[model samples]
Target chain A: MAILKTENLNYVYSQGTPFEKTAVRNVNLEIEKGEFVGIIGHTGSGKSTLIQHFNGLLRPSSGKIYLDGKDIWADKSQIRQVRFRVGLVFQYPEYQIFEETVYRDIAFGPKNMGLSEQETDRRVRATAQRVGIPESMLEKSPFELSGGEKRRVAIAGVMAMEPEVLILDEPTAGLDPKGRELILNQIKEYHKTMGCTVLLVSHSMEDVARYASRLLVMNRAEVFCFDSTAEVFKRSAEIEKIGLSVPQITRVFNILREKGIDIADDVYTVKYAKEKILEYLKSGGKLQ
Target chain B: MIKDITLGQYFPGNSVVHRMDARFKLVITMLFIVMLFIGSNTISLEVGFVFTAMAYLCSSIPVKLIAKSLKPILPILAFTTILNLFMITSGMPLFQWKFIAITDEAVETSVFMIVRILLLIAGTSLLTYTTSPVALTDAIERLLSPLKRFKLPVSELAMMMTIALRFIPTLIEETDKIMSAQKARGADMDGGKIKDKVKAVIPIIIPLFVSAVRRAGELATAMECRCYRGGEGRTRMRQLKSGAADYVSLGITIFFLAAVIFINAID
Candidate 1:
């Protein structure tokens, strides 16, 4: 069953004013349980606005959102309950860290959920361990930790809620390559271990291709395409036309295909491209 | 909802009001405020209202925007109206109830007080609405330059004012983002008792304060990198100048003030 779904969702900023802007218009999509879904779009493409709807942070202007087969806004009083079920980790999550100790910061979400002290502590420790936060580091002030550590603690705060659907908006934004890889890998591991649905919103196509089972493309407040990663990569030209480029490996393969090379057209990662090239060479295919 | 705040927002335009020197606008606003309170009779108030209306017309700003400026003060206006109606009784009674008597004097005073408050806000809001914050700060610095002789940190004060005004929108946006972020983490901000509402806001205020201090530190470092020393020997990109329209405006304002004072004496 789909863990989260949006049906004809629409959102408008500054509605009924001169500055009114239609941010998301008639977007419909579904995330299967335990699926790692990636959302890609350029700035102002309404990607952020769309994911914000999944957790009920933003109410739909005209449609409904379902979490675990229930309308999130069905009971207005229980909207916060929906949020607990759909965890959202915002970009630059480190900026949101404020507790004196990293442990307290990570416990904030579970505490707000009215969990018992023991349960909150257990969840926080479990989440911290999942995110690779050291036990010693959890007792230190969040400000005293390194940038990457602070980010982990912030992510753990949301994870402590043990949400059924985990949504992260550019979780690796502004981090070094090593830091980015660590954070992304940790998130993938968490998703796998918990069997939770994960939605990763990113501007980097390569990152999305490496993790997400399916891809959703947004352009100008509309869903341009929603399909498997390989299927979306087939429309690389259309994606580029919308000011977003496909993964570098996909571009290289597309170029090779245009030059009449006998390589698969769906190559997205560097390792896959290398293997495809080796296989083509061994098959006595000319370089063209 | 926090993003909808338009208080102290400046609309950029090439109108005569936008072109006036900030210092001159400040002085004129002060003079206009004094004149607004000087009117004690019906004829004087009428003259004062007409004078403000003409000034408003000359500013070329929409009257609706001026009216919008009164939004934040609606409660204050209502409170003052009620207070004046009940506290002042010196004429023919309109109604009597227990210890309170609604008199014609009370009615007149309430009307005059409400009008005075509205005119005061509308006239001053014109200054902010027309002048960009940077220009206003520059004008303030220039006008207070004489205070430097008394060892006052006029330039520093103006610089602080400028920075504060510049960050109002940014901070408001940050506040909205933080609130949404917390709300996404299941922090409820709506549908709660007074204590519950306050408790719900803890998640918001903590993150907001943290981000604000971080932003401030980053801003300070950025300023330092740019070699932003104190305001000594600083040159302005847009210098203030008094043109024919400015002189005309000043003259008209002075004439209106004279008329109001003269009318008050006659009444």
Candidate 2:
């Protein structure tokens, strides 16, 4: 079954005011279990608004969001149960960390879930370790940690809830190069070991190209494209037309193909580009 | 849920009231309040009300927004009315209870008080609706510039007020976002006991406070990067200069005051 689904979704912000705006409209999407869905959009393209609905942080103006084939808002009394099943890690989530210690901070979600003390402790430690936070640092204040470490604690807070579907909005924003790679690799490991669906909202096309199996592209509050990574990249021209910067490697390959180099067109990642170039040279395909 | 606040909000327009200098508008609003209090009798209050109505007609702002602003103060208005209706016993009694009584003079006094209070708020809200906060602050800094002779930090105080006003909406937006983030973590923010409601608010408030402090630090650093030292030698991009519009507004408001005072003296 699809882990999450939204049909005919519409959201009007600041309704009945002069600043009223339709942030999202007619958004139809589905995420299967264990699928790594990448969300890509320009700023103010409604990517944030669309994902907020998955966890019931926002109610759609007109539509339905079904989690595991059950409407999330069907019974308002049990909506918090839906929030537990679908975790949403907001952008720059470190700002949400407020507990005195990292351990207590990570346990906040589990405690809210009414877990026993021992169970909450177990989940907090396990999640902290899974997110690459050192066990010794768990007793220290989150404010005392570096920016990247604090972000890990914030992520672990949500991970401790152990939601079946994890959604991160710009989790890697404002991090240095090495820090970015470290967090992304840890998240990749977590996804593999937990076998849960993940939705990573990011601005970097290269990052999305490297990890996501399926891609969801938004433009001007509409779902422009929703397909596999390979299939979406096939319409690279259309993606670029919406003013999204396709990955640098994809642009480089596009230039090569234009000059009669006769290389395959689905080169989005640097690793794939390197393999294809070496294979082309081995197969006697010469530069024009 | 905090977005309903319309206090101190500036409505954009190009009417004569909006075009008047912010300094003149502030002075006129102050003088108008003094005039309203000076008009103690019915005839003087009638003059004050007519002048305020004329100002409102020139402002072009919708009365619906004014009513929204009054909504939060309805309890106070009602309480004032009740206190005046029973507390005063000088005139002939219309209805008498053991100690509480409603007299003709008391009823008239309540109506007069309510009308004066409503007109006072309307006149002041008109000034805020016409002038943007930035313009108002700039005017204030200029108006208070003479205080610098006594070593008072007038410009700095005005700048602080302006910055504070500028961030009210930002802080409110941050609060809304933090509330949603905590609620997504299964924090029961609604349909709970009083203590439970307070407990749910802790998660939201702590994060909002942290973010606000962080933003303040960032803003200070940004200002320092731009080499902001003090307002002593600082120049502005837009200078506040008085013109014919300013003088005309001053004259009109003074005329309003003179007319109210004359009516009160005759009464």
For candidate 2, the per-residue lDDT at A180 reads 90
In model 2, chain B matches the true chain B with a TM-score of 0.95
Check candidate 2 and list the clashing pairs: none
Tens-digit lDDT string for candidate 2 (B19-94): 8888888888889999999998988888778887888788888878788777677787899999999889889999
> Each model's DockQ?
0.70, 0.74
**Model 2 chain B worst lDDT run, 10 consecutive residues:** B65-74
Write model 1 residue lDDT over B226-253, tens digit each, in one string: 8889888877778888888778878888
For residue B204, model 1's alpha carbon misses the true position, in angstroms, by 2.7
Give me the runs in candidate 2 sitting further than 4 Å from their true place.
Answer: B86-105
- Give per-residue lDDT, candidate 2, residue B16: 87
